[model samples]
Target: MSKKMGLGKGLQALIPSYEDENKKTLRNITVADIKPNPKQPRQEMDKQKLQELADSIKEHGVVQPIVVREVPDGGYQLIAGERRWRACQLVNMDTIPAVVTEYTNIQAAEVALIENLQRENLNPLEEAVAYQSLINEFGLTQEELSKRVGKSRSYVANMLRLLALPDDVLALLSSGQISNGHARALLALDTDEKKIVAANEIIKKQLSVRETEKLVKELLQNKENRKKKNERAPEMEDLKDQLQGVFGTKVQIKTNSKGTGKLEIEFYNDDDLSRILEILLDDNSHVSRETN
Candidate 1:
């Protein structure tokens, strides 16, 4: 077994020699020359974020050189510092700061995955993907991956399972279109179509994570009922719309299983209440309405 290095030794491993404090090696590395590892688990990168990193690099040149290993194929392979390389490209720089060495495929992959995990800024999806890569490509067990990243085995396992979600759902997750809680809730549905539909409803209704979970449970129980029920529920929604249109304000209606429901009419203050009462009275309906 290769003994793990301490922090100082690890830093030295990446930056082998520290000469003059002011004199750093900054030369002869093109963005195109640095190839991303095929085994890299993080398949998605946020473009907007890359632009932001690039902007920062423009203001301050890359403070850190990416660690790389020269491939037998006559080019360099990225071991760590993909974000830095991306930032450099944003500035359209011909050369970047990098530390080049020779490493086996396993060593390069392990280094890259470990480096990204140590950096705290990675989003949950990125963390999950990296964890999956370690398991799939490097033959690391969940317990081993957990130890390497300072996470529990369950944490590692749960995150890895997130990748099994549908592509659209994963895209929503990566883009921050939905919360982890929301994604987890949607994952309960068995079909991709169900998951997608639930995802849409969660976004459209601004549903809370708990609410989404309950909604999923209810839908799963009534999966057959859902098909017979109106997909859009135009009739039910139209009632709220018409009420709001007539009231010239927001209206809320909630229904129960028996088709009995309550309507809550909203008002800003005494003035608004008075207007509503006046309209009700002027309508001259046969049924009398009570008010406080």
Candidate 2:
């Protein structure tokens, strides 16, 4: 499905149904009475952005009501809209508009994550961890999670893979020193050392995603070449030995997959060179005589 359409599906799933008047009623709840959701996906709020939001709340007031659920202590636990709740607190408003709902812990977590996702509030690492928590805590599969979050399965899978990155690399990603594309490209490498090196180069050189990908490809290709060189066949080794014996010197043979190769016979001095040349001339004369 198109991302736009899937996002709508996800939003609908996250939004609570308020068909009944009891569920739909907006109540003025005391700001101090509401506790933040422990499962809220967002870890850090942008202070500058929050200050701007608080200023806007002062001028315009909250346009949308925060969603909350009642706790045993007769207080409300914020299910969604923590940003608005925070803004209300910033302005020291006594009571804020809230929609009371009944939700289990899992439902509350889902609601909070989806709300932040819809608003694009959580960083990539935070988003991945939130998704992982739901999977581990609630046993949601990637497919199920994608449906719940209104994203493609690949998108969810790729996000989860980011967690495998080293802490330093993840820090780079979190701090915006490198983009997600750069991180993903680094995953092509098998070792953390290589990944860290590549990441540093990317930041220092200001490399683009495509450039990083190319660099990774070249590194992998060079690695494979070394592996192939180290794994030469016994037959090739035997051939090299025979050539060395025939030439009275060292010889080397290099071949590629297409049955194409190069052969080099080494000589240490003018005498050695003349000996090799005479050997080649004798072979040529023998071939010519055989053909005649």
Candidate 3:
């Protein structure tokens, strides 16, 4: 591991010792010569945000030096601060201040992922993808990944689960239509259909996390009710069918564990309701006459 370096200490830990002390000092490097890290996990940058950064760079100059490593052919490969490099380009700066660092490809990826995450720049889906890459490519366990990223193990695990979401839900997450909390709530639903339905509802209603949780719970409860209804005895189903035939409408019988239950009959109009009432009243009158 990288010595459990925290946010501020990360850059110092990644900086390499230069044989010539002057080489370690920050210096202006040609913006055109610095190439972006191919392994960089962040796929998108907000152009407006970059423009704001560029405006700042134009006004104050590049305050923080970007980190880069010397490439084999010539120039350099950016290890960190890609946003600043881009902003410098936007401001038409020929050269930007940078620190030269030496790191393996995996180390560079780790540093880039850490920087983006610490800044809360990457969306949930992007964060999850980045974490998965490190786990798959570098064989880092969830615990190790958590420690390296300065996040809880459960947080890492939860973030990884976002990747398993349906593409539609992932799209919502990527596009900022839904939040991480909303996505997490959607995970409670068992099927993709239900999840997509819930996701759409969330976006349409602009639901809060708690509201989304409540909605998922209702959906799961209805699902469980249907499953339980399907598991009922054949005799109960037959009874329901017989009742429906007598009532000339749909009938549902729901029972509890103790055998307590209610019978529900569906009637579409007043005439239909009157017909059902007549049957019940006639049956009651017949029973009363027999008792007399």
Candidate 4:
């Protein structure tokens, strides 16, 4: 038998007794009477796509009933099919076929979130925000949340990480200047300044995701090299200060783990050099050094 197409885990499994035909919960409700879901996962809707949906609804009418919950004030708060509802409104639809169901705030929010995820309509940021909301308010673990949204655990975790990105980088992502892959590459950097700079480089160079990853790798390698070459040991600093104190002149010391180093003694003139030499000879300090 050919099965009907549906959402994550089947909407009926997610919600018990959803639109049981025998119950006769379906009705034509005034469009103005229904209110938007406060927990609508989709933050932005493309106007062109919405207009297209409106045209389709106009021609074929709503193929499925929208779900809503009647509030205490006798008004309806939409639980699912927000796009259809909005499309109907665009066409100045007076009423829509809705299944009035009894659901608590949590159930309504979950249904709305799953609907958006299954439809794959939300941008990365919007998806992250929705995931965060569910985890924060409902205390859902990533594993649990992934199953509900029909995504792998890694996908859900990666989406949550996007929330940690600085606002400007996120803006770059949200505005379509960079893709989620680009954003993931930025996450490898250790600081916000680096992330922002890399994001700008991505836009200016029009770098692809692979190129961005390579850029990030090179930046990190350079940083590591700098750290190794310029790293000043604490004992080296102490020796430099002591040498400066004894010679009455500035002293610089640099060394690596191999105990190879250089000692630079500043001198004002020949007199200063003679004084430094006298001190060094008196101490009989022996040293060997290598240039990095």
Best by TM-score: 2
- Give the TM-scores of the predictions, in the order they appear: 0.61, 0.83, 0.79, 0.76
* Each prediction's RMSD to truth: 13.7, 5.6, 6.6, 6.0
RMSD of 4: 6.0
Score candidate 1 by lDDT: 0.74
Off by over 4 Å in 1: 5-32, 101-103, 118-123, 220-292
Candidate 3 whole-model C-alpha lDDT, 0 to 1: 0.84
For model 2, the stretches where C-alpha displacement exceeds 4 angstroms are: 1-13, 16-20, 233-240, 250-269, 284-292
Candidate 2 lowest-lDDT run of ten: 283-292
Give the alpha carbon lDDT tens digit for every residue of 1-292 in model 4. 2232233575655443544776677889999999999899887888999999999999999898899989998889999999899999999999999888777666777778777766777788988998899899989999978876778999999999998899999998888899999999999999999999999999999999999999999999888766765665554566666677788998877665455778777899998899888888885664433334
Candidate 3 per-residue lDDT over residues 162-273, each given as its tens digit: 9878999999999999999999999988889889999999989989999999999988877777676667667677777777777789999889744488989999999999
Please identify model 3 stretches exceeding 4 Å from their true place: 1-13, 16-25, 238-292
Better of 1 and 4 by TM-score: 4
lDDT of 2 by residue, 178-238 (tens): 9889989998899999999999999999999999999999989888876776666765777
lDDT scores of the candidates, listed in order:
0.74, 0.83, 0.84, 0.84
Ranking the candidates on TM-score from highest down gives 2, 3, 4, 1
The pairs that clash in candidate 1 are none
